[model samples]
Target: MAARPEIAAVIWDFGGVFTSSPFEAFNRFEASRGLPKDLIRRINAANHHDNAWALFERNEIDTARFDALFLEESTALGHPVRGGEVLPLLSGELRPRMVVALKTCKQHFKVGCITNNVVSMHSPGQDEVQRAAGAMGQVMPLFDAIIESSKAGVRKPDPRIYLMMCELLAVEPGRCVYLDDLGINCKPAAALGMRAIKVVDVDQTLAELADATGLTFGAESVA
Candidate 1:
């Protein structure tokens, strides 16, 4: 078989790829409230392109507006959920194994991150922001480029965001490997000629990264 095309860069999605999924947190919240599973995800998926969650991620709305709007959206879906309640759930615990794989990938290829983050929810001055940075600081500095949707005014599933990362890395799309937790986000990357991996779990993702980059990560406990 012909050898796979050489990969020049590795792009990652921050939240779900590096950390436990916020969807897990959302489900837990839903269970606690006796709401349907995946309700928050459903709400966000509905009218995805122009939803309140999408606007919040692009920084087109402030926290207060997102709160009201998200509540409105959720209420329309059945349960009344405050956006304020959902904001805190977005930060999932970091996965040290994934960080190890990322570090391994960085040694071989240019590394970049494209995250659909919210500006209002992740204000630099917020305590949660400080804590999150402190917790993930070791991994943050390793990236050659980091694009936040809130700052970039574009989110994943939009072709421009993936293209922007390639431009920033000075790499061709066909020569890059991109990993994201959401299939919707992965579609555009794959369409752009990137080798896109939809992350399902740490070990699975690591195994694929290993296959793509031809690198092996240590199994030591860094957690």
Candidate 2:
């Protein structure tokens, strides 16, 4: 049996974790819209490299300014492809692996989410957003806190957001376990003494968390 995790709480990232990152979906949308990947790249400018949204989520750039930049570049990519489409395309479907992890981890430890996300993308959704929100509400009950760049105005790698989540969960940094898809996001958490996990899939993370707490998580019922 796998050992239990030690952290009083486990924090997860939203975009790449609970929800699918519309990476492939964006490519599909682009190809269908006749917006070549290169053109999209040019529109986003250095977003891919510097992670502009992460900065925006961190409130390093005000929403209007960020939207303007994205709109200008995207319009340059395709006049018909408005900046409004950005949110829909970037929101990916939830991964089952992450769901399993969330569902399973919730029972053993306090769970929370810390993510670098855009407010424009996440804020409005009577339709798509609501759909995504519904899905999130399912597993998210597992979390003790939910921290997002859009809402918190601080993104990952910032360290403050990590601390905020720990604060909300009422757990010390050393007693928290943070998981994210990006190595950079994990760096600060690990430095702060949280047991950090970079999620490639989920098996390795589950095993590690299990080991930390000396508990057997996950039976044949779920992941």
All models: lDDT?
0.86, 0.68
Q: What does each candidate score in C-alpha RMSD?
A: 2.5, 4.0
Model 2 per-residue lDDT tens digits across residues 133-206: 66666766677788877777666688788888888888899987777777878999999998887766556666
RMSD of model 2 against the true structure: 4.0
What global local distance difference test value does model 1 have? 0.86
Off by over 4 Å in 1: 1-5, 124-130, 221-223
The residue-by-residue lDDT of candidate 1 on 1-223, one tens digit each, is: 2223498999999888877898998999999999999999999999999999999999999989999999999999889999998887887777888887777777678999999988754556556556565655767789999999999999988999999999999999999999999999999999999989999998788778778877766555245
The Cα error of candidate 1 at residue 200, in Å, is: 0.8
TM-score of 1: 0.92
Candidate 1 colliding pairs: none
Off by over 4 Å in 2: 2-5, 33-66, 73-82, 120-126, 203-223
Best by TM-score: 1
Per-candidate TM equals 0.92, 0.74
In model 1, the Cα lDDT at residue 53 comes to 94
